[model samples]
Target: MHAPMPLISTMVGGLVLAFILGMLAHRVKISPLVGYLAAGIIVGPFTPGYVADLSLAPQLAELGVIMLMFGVGLHFSINDLLAVKHIAIPGAILQIAAATLLGFCLGQMLGWSLITGILFGLCLSTASTVVLLRAMEERQLITTKKGKIAIGWLVVEDLVMVLALVLFPVITEMLSKEGVSPTEILYSLIITLTKVIAFIAFMLIIGKRVIPWLLIRAARTDSDELFTLAVLAISIGIAFGAVELFDVSFALGAFFAGVILNGTEFSHRATNNTLPLRDAFAVLFFVSVGMLFNPAVILESPFALIGTLFIILLGKSIIAYGLVRFFKHSKETALTVSISLAQIGEFAFILAGLGLALGIADSKLHNLVLAGAILSISINPFLFTIADKFALSRLRKNTTLTDTTSKETAKPIDKQQPMMPFSDHIVIVGYGIIGQKLLSELNDANEEVVIVDHGKEKVRLLKMEGHHVILGDGISEEVLTLSGIAKAKWLFITLDNPYETAQIMQMTKSLASHVKIVTYGSHLDEIEYLYDQGAYEVIEVKKDIAITMASKVIPSL
Candidate 1:
């Protein structure tokens, strides 16, 4: 019989074990990451029985990093990122410095060299992207202000780590007993930074145009398989190219690729399409990391492990919390951000590996870093879950103060858009660009209207402006009822979202069968479908645009 293929067997073994453990973790009310890592340790070469292919594991896991970083880029919003940069940029730098100092002190006590200590300190300074993103997702806080700040803080850390990766060799030589020249250090730093900057510039300037245009062209082929292939290609291809040409990390490359793609209209579709693959590969990534961990380190270097964990889990967290509170944010925001940064992952492992290769970190340090990472990551979710409850409880106690408070009492009244009740009026769903223009024309014609929007901020602004607005999802029946859908003379759904527009139309028909429904679709392809979904009239936006342009340029036609 032919020998079992390591690739297939490794994937199968890791996935199966991870699933069993993940399910158990779920039942016990813990992060599935705990189980995934446990699964890795079991199949890892350290534990002995049915060890997964050591060499093959990393190759599989690397895909996970590429895909996960790619997804990060996909959701990386420039506008939201900018809004929190004031705090995120400086906060991340200071917090990292604090953690490094704590680690350095601990390293010095252990009699480690300056270079080894610096490497150790750097390893503990950054949090795992996988762990933080999962925590935020579990709590559905990704779009909240707290989530935005935490993500932005992480972005800065990732950038710093990327630069550190560039300067790794220089720092190793400069800080060692056999020190290098200031000129050599400067030369290396300048060269590494130049490559990094050039990579970012190229990705933003050239990649921004090429990537979106490429996706648009691929999407026009109307092939789901091809579109998915195209996205994966861009993500992996750029990640590989960045490492080869620019001496940057593949994760950074994939991340920028996602950021550029985020600017396109097809971004949402792209996110939904590849999310499954990203998620699957992400599981592999965690499992592979687990495989490298030697559980014996717990018994082998008990004190060292504890010290590393102290710096990573407690020290770093305290620094993050204090820094956030120092900036005058509420206690809840501080706690959430603190908990988010309490663990280190991919970068720590990368640093540990590099340290081992360069003889800067001893075998003891390497294993301790792994032990610290595994334990810290496993424990992080519980910390977040506890913080979440505390914030929730505090919000309930004083709704006006805490970040997690419900909108009913916590939301400030928008003085600009005051609410007014109206009947025998049009109810417009989706206050997007088209909806806004339609409201302007109808209001000018003395046609009373009430707007329903999903965005809390938009609804607040409209309510403050005195243009009757309901701050709830248009797809919800309760929201429609609250918007006076039953009494409204007409329901005009101006949103170009065909799926949502159809659902709303169906709901409107069921609620008020006689209510007139007029809707707009961005493409003529879905016009008939919308009509079938109970729209009395469906306006085709692109077709109308084409007609208008034709009328302007060729009036006779």
Candidate 2:
């Protein structure tokens, strides 16, 4: 029998293991990221099983990072960042400085050189884009004030790391040559900043127009395959070009590419088409991280591991919390932002790998960073749960105090009937064509309807039309609650994305068991899956259209 190619074997093995473990993780009510990581460790060289090609795994993982950052860029606009800039920019920088100093101190205690310690410190200073985004997406916080700050904070961190990556070689060379002056370092910094600024300008001035025009052309071809291909090509091509021509990170390049395309009419369509690839590659990225871990680190350097975790989980979080609170944000927002950034991932790995390549950091430091990443990521969800409960308790206490004060100071007024809360209403999850039609019919029948949609413009228009609308992803619990799902008589999901549709159905079923859910699907398997997920009715859109056409023509005949 012929041997399988290295690339093929690595991809197959990694994905198969990730799926099995991811499912198990889900079954156990933990983040599937835990399972993906476990799968990596099992298939890694450290274990006595079929090891995937270590060389190729990282390359694939890089693609995952690129895709992920692109997705973030699509959702994130320059305006969103500006809104949170007062906190995100300064907060991220200060927090990074604090974390780096802590890491540097720890490295000094371990007897590492100044350069090595600096690099080590830098590795632990930044949060992983994948982990933070995943957590925010799960809680439906990506569009919220808190989510915007966290994302903005992360963007600042990523930018700093990119600059560091550019300057690492110069700094290392300076260290080697005793005659190198501070002016040389300053010049290098200026040059690097210029390149970054130039790249940004190019994207905003040229890319914003060109990328969208290309997508519009592709979309006009009326081929789903071609449109999707165009998106992938643009994302990957721009990312590659950024690295090669602009000497910037792929994540930053892809991010700008997404940002440029975010203004286009086709942004939503682009997101839907690329969602699956983004998800699949993200899984591989986590697995690739796991494969780098050596379980022996726990036993061999127990103190080192503890120190690393302490810095990542406690030191960084505390610093972030302080920074956010100092900026006059609420305790809840501070807690959420701090806890969300408690782990390090892709950028850490990149920095660590660069340190190794440059001979400034050793294997031990790399392993420590990897171990820290795995442990921190695994426990991040549990931390969020604890934080949520704590926040809830505080809110309850405040509510109770307010109620007590109201009772003590209340004066009797002319007795008046209180306004009734919205209930027994129909909730429409999307404001697309089907949603618009449903709303019109429901309004004509005198039924109360609440609209839940992610499109800002759509939600604004709906509200202007005097419709009750919650502007957020339907999958978010907060959005569902705002839509009054508990008292909703009928829930209609008009979203085109099957994954999102299923998620909405499942969340709705859990939140309001009595409400009926009706959704439309284009495929038989998707329809069946939606039914399995507790959808009351799943309309087969294509089948329905065909049947309707045939019925009309046959009647005429």
The number of clashing residue pairs in each candidate reads 10, 0
User: TM-score winner among the candidates?
Assistant: 2
What tens-digit string does per-residue lDDT give for candidate 2 at 131-157? 888787766567667888999998888
Evaluate all candidate structures by whole-model CA lDDT and list the values in order: 0.80, 0.81
lDDT of 1 by residue, 1-557 (tens): 98879988888999999999999987886668778878988999889788998897657766877887788788777676688989999999999998988888889988998878888898999998778887776554565678889999998888787667667865675656355678877877787778888999998889988988899889999999889889889989999999899877777788888888788888888897898888888888878878878888899778888899999888998999999999899788899899999998877876776676577888677777878877887788789768856753552343121122124443432322223345688999878888899999999999878888755678668765757777545665656776677778889887655777787888888877878999877655689889888888888888888899899889885
Scored against the true structure, residue 263 in model 1 reaches a CA lDDT of: 81
Q: Largest lDDT belongs to which candidate?
A: 2
TM-score of each: 0.71, 0.77
